[model samples]
Target: MNAEMQVILDQLEEENLGIRKKAIEALKKWEYQLELEDACLLLEKAAEIKPLCEDEWDNPSYALVTAACIFIHEDMVPVIEKNILRYSLRAAIKVLSFLLVLNTESAISLYKKTFHQFYDHGFACTGV
Candidate 1:
């Protein structure tokens, strides 16, 4: 990996959650350049880090989810599904966006299956 990628990866390993969140945000800039190995590494790290983020003001799950989408890997769905309900509305919307980008038919089917769940989870509001 390049020095820039190295730094981001190092940041992701930091004990400071804020630093890790910033690292995820930084990964967004590397979307087009990320190799498969790097994307997988990032996805693994993000999956591990995402569940630890509990603060509403400092959540990194959204950035992590978007980074997975940016990588365009087939593995994104499981990662998204694992945490969809835990994410804030903003992050859940990102899940929907990823589905739309993946396939309309699949998105429609998944939406049909989960629409009630989403509504029951209090995701029916229009306001962001």
Candidate 2:
């Protein structure tokens, strides 16, 4: 992994949830500058850390999803798709919903990919 990805993964493993949450939030701000592979890797790591609270404020998934939105390329969509069902469905919906807000060509492709995944999983796009 690259230095940034290492930092992200390390943060995910931090004992302090505050530190991990801040790191994830910072990653979101830096997402556009990261390589697509690195961003996807970081998201994977973020997803592995279970949420400590149901509220978005305490959940790292919010940050992870926001970060993922920045690099929603066709190639990375599969990575997100593969892990969608592994994490909290509510969290996945929150992240994927943010992805839909991105209007870039890559974002549109990811939106379709994610939409299909949610639909296949029996989630209603309209409600989530």
Candidate 3:
């Protein structure tokens, strides 16, 4: 990763949520400059962070997911599938859109599973 990418990655660990959100925004703005390695790292980090909001704008993790989707690869599928259920509906939809484009068959299966999971179980963590 480049120095700039490393710095942004560090910002994700900051105590201040605003800083983390800005770091994710910076990643989006610098998407063209991100290598596959950088995207992979960002995706990993982003997936681990809980979203700050239901809307994508205020959710750093969701924003990062969208940005990372630009560099989507076959290897990233597991991460995407594993994390989708944990995301807010809006963010999950955004992720599902990318999955659809990446691999329709898997995406369809995941979509069904996600829909069933959400419909049957609801979000236990969010109480929604």
Candidate 4:
């Protein structure tokens, strides 16, 4: 990673929402030049960080994750899959959906494991 990009990555940890948004934008602008590892790191960080939700429907984390996922190669699927438990049922659905569009095989491979939690959560009323 370049010095400028490193600085932007550091900005993700800033307490100020505006600074974080700016940093995310900067990284997006530099997406073409981002390394796979750097992109994965950014995606991981974006997934871990809580979004600033001034507007109820708009989530910066979703946008950041989607954009960051663009630069992440298929080889990093394991790293991302391992973090599935960190996501909510709804979030895991969205991530799985996103992955489905990106790579059907990989998404299907993970769905059985990842969606089981969601299925179980919804089926708690039933004895199944």
Where model 4 places Cα greater than 4 Å from the true spot, the runs are 2-4, 27-33, 52-60, 87-94, 122-128
Winning model by lDDT = 3
Distance from true position, residue 42, model 2, in Å? Answer: 2.3
Residue 66 local lDDT, model 2: 60
Candidate 3 lDDT tens digits, 1-128: 78877887688777677887788788668655467666666666665666544445555566666777785776666776766765545667677777778766776688677777767876332211
lDDT of each: 0.59, 0.63, 0.66, 0.58
Candidate 2, residues 1-128: lDDT per residue as tens digits?
56765787678668787877777677657635467877687557546767655456555655665666564555665666566655456657755665566455665676677778767867643211
In order of appearance, the predictions have TM-scores of: 0.60, 0.63, 0.72, 0.64
Q: What is the lDDT of residue 79 in candidate 4?
A: 58
What lDDT does candidate 4 reach at residue 111? 61
For candidate 1, write residues 72-96 as lDDT tens digits: 5555555555555656466567767
What's the C-alpha lDDT at position 16 in model 2?
84
| Local accuracy of candidate 4 as per-residue lDDT tens digits, 42-124 | 55654575544554323434544555566446755675686555543334555667666666577668766666765876623
lDDT of 3 at 88: 49
Question: How displaced is residue 90 in candidate 1, in Å?
Answer: 2.2
Better of 1 and 3 by TM-score: 3
